[model samples]
Target chain A: MPRATSRATLFEVAAQADVSVSTVSKVLNGRAGVSDETRARIEALLQDHRYQQRSGKRQAAPLLDVLCYEVDSPFGSEVLASIEQSARLQRIGMVLSGATEQATPYAHWVDDVLRRQPVGVVLIACKLSADDRQRLRSRNIPLVMVDPAGTPAPDVPSIGSADWNGGYQATRHLIDLGHTRIGIITGPADMMASTARLSGYRAALDSAGLTGEPELVRPGRFHHADGLEQGRALLSLPDPPTAIFASSDLYALGVYEAARTLGLSIPADLSVVGYDDLSIARWAGPPLTTVHVPLVAMAEQAVHLVMRLNDEPEMAFSRIDIDTTLVVRGSTAARNISK
Target chain B: MPRATSRATLFEVAAQADVSVSTVSKVLNGRAGVSDETRARIEALLQDHRYQQRSGKRQAAPLLDVLCYEVDSPFGSEVLASIEQSARLQRIGMVLSGATEQATPYAHWVDDVLRRQPVGVVLIACKLSADDRQRLRSRNIPLVMVDPAGTPAPDVPSIGSADWNGGYQATRHLIDLGHTRIGIITGPADMMASTARLSGYRAALDSAGLTGEPELVRPGRFHHADGLEQGRALLSLPDPPTAIFASSDLYALGVYEAARTLGLSIPADLSVVGYDDLSIARWAGPPLTTVHVPLVAMAEQAVHLVMRLNDEPEMAFSRIDIDTTLVVRGSTAARNISK
Candidate 1:
């Protein structure tokens, strides 16, 4: 961190805001975590003190940090690839860290980030705890989230896709094709996206005058193995669903495996739909029909947002969600099997 | 770098070797890019000076660096995830950097690596340029290659799977299935792995007393899109091969798309074989029969080697190759059509 100018150092702002010097610095730097009220107070103090260019010791050498819940997630690779490309274009250093799934929050992850003193951080499918959130804010570091795994905190800005609508459309597509017995596979039950998607599935079923069977809905991680296991369970049920809606492309791919294991042909015997049209989706057997999540666009925009947040601390932050569309490929077909 | 012992600094070693200060540093630090004669001379000087723990500013911070040419590759994700796990266990920091193919040799990548001063670097399917090799060695950093894209330099150590044998076995399997005309998709023509696999394919045909046609081979990247295009082309030929061997699991998935587009069923119409046996491979339609590349084990071993290199500068450097096996599932079948 650079020292402030002689006219009004950060100390004065801290004194005026009745906050710690670090809090005042964070406010000055436009880092996330500070409450709007506190930020406003700090802003007023800076103006009152005739804030000048408060710069010292800061360099452009700081790395850009990326925090992901599961770096191995199917959707993670594309998003990180895009973020990395953008970082390289600007010659910014980047460090990617994943939160361990252990009971405790990332063991020493925040401390490592603090030590690196990254210019800003981008989180994907990750939610921060109160302590780490506070630490990042007080440190005056900018943070942004991409497709946050759950509902973001009150103040954390994020970029996500219209997953609920995507789910609704995918379910409705299957319904429109004369499919009443539809099974749905979702992400971890706690994830807001998963719940919203589940709700959308229910809504579609209700609108179609079909009561979705509780036995048909399976919840698991956003991974292929989970998809395969859940899909097999669904397919093995007494009254198996004719169509399956997987919450993620990876999940849907697992459904493909389940269908294959049973010697069932896609579309002919079982219609399947996936979300997050990751590049691999189009290459899946029968070219997976999926809901397209603008992965690259979201990543690019998140980087842009964090950069802006780094430069203009005074700018207000909010959530931005891109609309998702159903991409009908070769994976869906009209119901051919009798109930 | 920290200053050396009272007997002599890196400058004295450079003067004695009639080489640049960086080369002498490389020799003493046990980094690659230094010649045998020069390294021997530098070692003799250190011994003559009675080098009493001629330590420099190296610290145990011990952050591991990982570089890959294609960050979005199917195999890249699993390898990195494993590397991250190993790194966390050792309480070491890991930084992953992707070499952008847009021309400039990893624009400013070396500068960023130097700034972090990583204890060691692991390159996956990426070969450093001469300039980068020199820079890393001069900085006294250890380097290891994982599944090197091409034949690694003599001095640099590497850990890779027996791709040639894997390719040979996959071809032999197809031949055993009574398929005389087997098409093959390889990675970039320049990559050593690509050529090696292609060689193995030819060897299999020779061993079977069958003629191998160059027209049946397609050389491209280890990517799905390339697989789709090449697979489509091969299948569209007048006398399409009864079975296809794709070099990467990702490439085989693309072939699945082509098969779908051409209305051909896996194992039933056009048998397929894949390599790398990535997690997605099992979920691929028909549970792709692939050459299992021990991705996780290779990454773990690479990290272990780099750590050892970091600790013992005088330890001999050598290449290690793990065995690859054909994991048969449901993707191959006996040829039913006349050749």
Candidate 2:
């Protein structure tokens, strides 16, 4: 039986090769300035010991670290899963640095990855500051940003779904259903999706002869509880709208709950619509009418962009916009004939 | 300006060191055959090239690859997210391999991982067979099984939630409420959780002086559509049970839908209960009365177990059972007063 050999040390290799550690590293990395004989001997020894060589230098596998901040949400979980799948297919291992967007800044996460000297990084729920982005550019580290917007970092690449189009389609669907007095529930003001969805809502109303009603529009964070509260608030208004378009499925589901609590039947009392047609949408009490965003496709695109950046550092920055569709379920009807 | 140094090559170093490729490798790895004088010369040369004498050998970071086989369920995404988070915290870079349990056998996945020589592997949705387990054990590759019930290799570690206990508690709650004619909608027969939950339901009934009714039991396969069909089937029986227990929240939600379709009211005409109180449960149409499984905690535990296995291979094998809680809502009520 060939007994497993104890792992070899760098010092032993350096001493036996009659060369300095730096010379061995340069030779292993395929860097210049070493004698041909020394490089050959090092290569032979590396092969004999089964040491992995990279860039002509013998070293272990390269590291690709990831930092996900504010990852406690369901969307964060989905994005993380997709990235993991993509990373695995690429055959690159990743290290996760802890930080949530709600609790930590991007600077702290970047510092952690820098300390580890990772070959590349994927940033989720993290927005790089101009200074941080500059520093990363200086270091020549490749980066791929997911769902970030309004950043003028011309060099960095980003991947995200087309929320603007999704929102537009969702809003337009309700309009086509002959709903003039439509209500809109949006995500936070700071988020790109929220603003884009709001824009879509406005565009839909504009396309029709209807004016946007400030009273009917409410903004909240992307959460089910937020949706519930907003739903209750909207329903309490003296002249409640004929139709409501929530920015997220969770919010729409909340509206369904609110309708139930108010003793009002869906489509009979109020028409409701939602976005992000999550897994639960199809099972929502009334089977929610919502926009279906291609989550898996977005994740795959993000990973592809990140990996592409790794090979061609100078590749032109690209943006991928996946399409969304409105899945009409039982939630919407011709503006309650009774109304 | 320091122009980016072109990567160094092995030939360049060997020629400069005036040693054969084999000699250089031996000296660098610090093998016994190399003379002390030759070793010193190699060490000096490596140092000049900026390579640190790492234990007399040059080494790089190790890679940890992960393959996520598609399981064709929404819950698979959530489980995958937990595994990714855990892997990231451990500083292990993961490579995701996508395989579905329905399409590929466990042995093929094991062979692929062995060939890649990842530091370790995390298999999702792939069920291990007796032969596959033996091969994994012989290779001595650390593996962490998620949601696994049994493994042929006793030494291999596994992690999952306490589904049997959860099921028992859920059924006992319904029995305590004086529901003697309780019905159950179970997941797929092959799933360990389904079997355990069925056993729990039977135990609850037995303890409550009620015999299990085969007519009231239905196989649902854990899908909302299936649950809907099963719900309709149960209600169509000559004499339907007063209360129904769905093995999963998604299925229970489907039951709620079925009730609506049949013009029956929940907790009045038919009391409904579900498991895995997912996020949508609370805000569900009826505020589902169901069992809550701590998904985040379970995820954290699985990751912790895998990381621990990496360091202390001999750590005594133990199962971590997470407690379940019953959240009462509008779905369950006192047995019909009219009856």
Candidate 3:
């Protein structure tokens, strides 16, 4: 593997690639007129040699690159807005891009990022391939992740909310309301955050001396559709849950729709709790009782960490999980025995 | 006033400001070490002499500046996400910033823009001061607005949805459903879009030969609180209208909350129609019947127009309003006669 301390000069790289210095410069600056094959070869050679461009020569404004999995999702947008505000406060330009459906950026995204030469990159609910990581590393660009989609690489620092505690608190709130038969809609199984939340839910039930029912735990992908489908199924069971802990705010809305479709009203007929106290939580018909993820704090931490890494590249890899708190609202209520 | 055709050299600006060329260069590049007083004086001279920096000297990555009001608002985020996508497709970076509460950018936002030297600037539901406009103009940076707040400057191109037609279509939908007594919740009085929507609502009532009641008209700032406040006020009347047209989707959610608080159910007790069919509309309990604003298309147009203006700086000021359509969902129904 190429080392950061050893970097090849532009002239040396051009000589090794058997290309003119201007041709190498064109690829380096993301200018047009370079053939794709030659560009690829030069990029591979640069990576092999670990060519690091001099930062002082970059004339662009200071920028922070942000790559989000779903830029329009309620959670994604809120996180993005927070980061944009923080970046603005620090006088850093934010360059935002949406990841592809696979929770990764498009093919040419890395090329573009190399061209922009942002001070650092922040990935929200997305992952980067090893090759992409090496490319960014070769350029000496720092990267930080917020709530990474999958298992975060050991070397990359990440920021996330305390999903286990949030899940435990949400479930505990429902349990305190005399809801023994409570259902839960879980996020994607592969995500550590989702699994942690689910484990917390089970722990809460076990600690309460109640036997958790496997049938009551339904799987979902943190989508509204999943909420609607799973919610309807849960409600259709012989012994339906009196309350539900939806793992996401979006899922809670779907549950609301499900209840509405089944002629049930929130809190009165079927109580619900949600995660992520996004603005939608307040706008829900009855207002949602939810776990508030400190998105703003997390965003600030992400930006701060990325900048810190840029300044101190040798800093050890660390994970910071901000605290999560449950916000009580109108959606949750005590069980109605008569029903 | 600085003319776009006339230009001044850095040396001339420095001479006029009684400073060395390097000091003037420091201010131009937004580098530190220049005193505020001196920087101000140099900026005045640069603007006075119509100093247009040579574009070729800029080595920064291509960027499109986006200034949005209420960056986290449902409407704003969606528009931002769209523009980000379009900019990425064009290999242009998007530098996003949230405007202050006053619908104007912070004091240093313009200075930052000048330093970035973006291809162009796009303002979303935000306005620029005359001085700010002049600064951008002196730099020969093109500006475009999307659903601009207040009155759009005559010289700036803007992209907007057909608010008037949308309002007409929404009100007409309720009318066609056999509702004669209809109430309307309008957006901020100052925004041209809001006024145009109100006019369309009035035109629809007039064409239907129904007497529009002054008591039925209420005001809002396109916020959920306004929706709830105005909705409750209208619904509390001794003889309240059976149907309501909320000018924005957020207002519709507030109206939903208000109705829930008043023991009223949507479509069954009262019919509600909302504008700007954002994702929240679908997530609403009964789902919202709303006017669909072509936000993606509008965003694309904003990017395309800004880029076009950059290339053709002398293009005439123009406004494009994409068509709006009424999407009938579960929120609206025939007026209940027994209520």
Candidate 4:
């Protein structure tokens, strides 16, 4: 199963595997009839030989595969909607899969994708294992990631929002509203987007000549419970900040709950700023003031990139970051010094 | 082309169209190379002859088609996630399409579906025209609806929650809190779910020996704006109800905003009840008391029904309604007499 330096034809692979070329073709095309044991042997041979199917020779219907983390999450759903719309405009069907809790597809997902033989794969805040990547490569399937989890491979292109700028804008909005002591709810530490956002928050605080207190910063996995727990802890402090910057809209909702639990009102008692202006941001009670991540543009870019890469697989991969902006809404207000 | 009284074979249709059997086969299988005019002519002849492809003979990849009104809507997203998971577990791909504003797919949607030749089609709160329905019927494709709009055709089985029960329970909860005057935000009139809920509300009032007030019943399209506008109107009445029953979670959020604008506190000033216990329900500032529509179960049922229909197309269509339950949370409480 050692990798071959040169490409091997289907006939050659079939000969090496001691199977008919049609059997090898069936395995390559993901058609049924080949036994599991034989299919696995042929698959390994195909991978080792680095067999590449000619472009435009796909037998399956035009489909774009999407692997997303938490498909029902606000962020995932909105991005999926954008991608679905883009794919529809191009008359391509979209096949969606939910990644595991670790942000990777389940063990059988790659197998399913291979069988489906989609034109391209789009991952939204999801990751693919090296073996899975090799499998797709052997099949000549193009993949593009949206807000990839962890450090993305240099060879793989990705689309993401300007997280640092978003974090800075959210913090600056609060600071501009006369908030010197601001609490923050940061996303998971491991995610680059989260780290960048935290860094931006720190930069904003440093530029404003405000001391960054460890107690004012809380870590989270971008879950509502994280926001609620950290928000409660922050608001319960002896000298609580007048404002809080929640890095995600879901987190902001959690902060809202925390405030309500403690009998505090938004803006008046604790001005709040959130990030990722998803539709729920507008549906929030106070119509959350937050940083708007350009998810629609990012989704469109990911789809377009997939198409481009499918056509020209040799093109150099590129990373794209759409701009982010602060949306002023009813959630943020001037810090009331009287409190 | 007039409908034929008897089923016709492919060879007979090819003979009538003056085309080779292989050419007719290409058109039936949605293969390329057939001219549009010729394809149309052949399709009409096939339809006139009521040509039906063998169910198991579909050559397209195993896929299920989904047509949703708004793929990004909280309800739609949740349902889609459930279906995707179900499809994944069954080793089938789901092809998603967003329906038009009218709750019907676009003109070319049926054509695209035919080309894809999915195992079956699932409509999430979407509709199909008679012509489109006939097209799917001609191809022997199964169709199932989840929470269908309008009166579902008796022949087309649909899966939905116990809307009447849901509405009754919501209104009953408010009545149990000793609030005799309760306002309701109703969904669109054309939707059976909305009418069922509205009827349930009336029944609950009748059972509680309370007269329903026309002024208190507000119409909405299950949108945030509808809730906000209707909530404002209800609250501005000379004598406002102490409790509001928002049929949708988005509407509940809008009502929350309306209450905020009017300087009223939830539960203390006015209790609110919402339907569809989406994830946002838990994240609501004062966690919303909502009717839990079993979206996961409904989705699973829709997917399973599609599969069943595909295997046994003659199986009698059965409409299933999963149960709904009320979830008590921070949003609703006993009516306050002090106000």
Candidate 2 wrongly placed segments (more than 4 Å) = A1-74, A77-99, A103-120, A134-139, A149-154, B1-99, B103-126, B130-140, B149-153, B337-339
TM-score of each: 0.80, 0.75, 0.94, 0.93
Model 4, runs deviating above 4 Å? A1-8, A11-27, A30-50, A58-60, B1-8, B15-27, B30-48, B58-61
Tens-digit lDDT track of model 4 for A12-69: 8889899998998777666678898998798788876777776657543599999999
DockQ for the candidate 2 complex?
Answer: 0.18
iRMSD of prediction 3: 1.7
lDDT per residue (tens digit) for residues A34-67 in model 2: 7768866765554455443221121133456666
Number of the top candidate by DockQ? 3
DockQ preference between candidates 1 and 3, better one: 3
In the order shown, the candidates' DockQ scores are 0.30, 0.18, 0.68, 0.67
* Candidate 3 - chain A - TM: 0.91
TM-score of chain B of 4: 0.92
Task: Report lDDT (Cα) of residue A148, candidate 2.
Answer: 62
Per-residue lDDT tens digits of candidate 3, residues A1-339?
434443347788889889998998877766778898998898898877777654534444688999998898999999999999889888998989999987899877887888888889999999998878877776778999999987779898999999999999999998899999999999987677899899989999988998789999999988899899999999999999999999999999999999989989888999999999999999998899999999999999999988888777768877999999999999999999898
Off by over 4 Å in 3: A1-60, B1-15, B20-60
Across residues B1-339, which tens digit of lDDT does each residue of candidate 4 receive? 432433347878888889998998777666778998988888888877777676866443589999998899988899999999998888888898998888999766887888888999999988887767767877888999898886678888889999999999999999999899999999988888999999999999999999999999999988889999999999999999999999999899999999999999897899899999999888887889999999988988999999998888778876899999999999888988777
Number of clashes recorded per candidate? 2, 93, 0, 0
lDDT string, candidate 3, B132-220, tens digits? 88778767788999989877889889999999999899999999988898999998887888999999999999999998899999998
DockQ of 4: 0.67
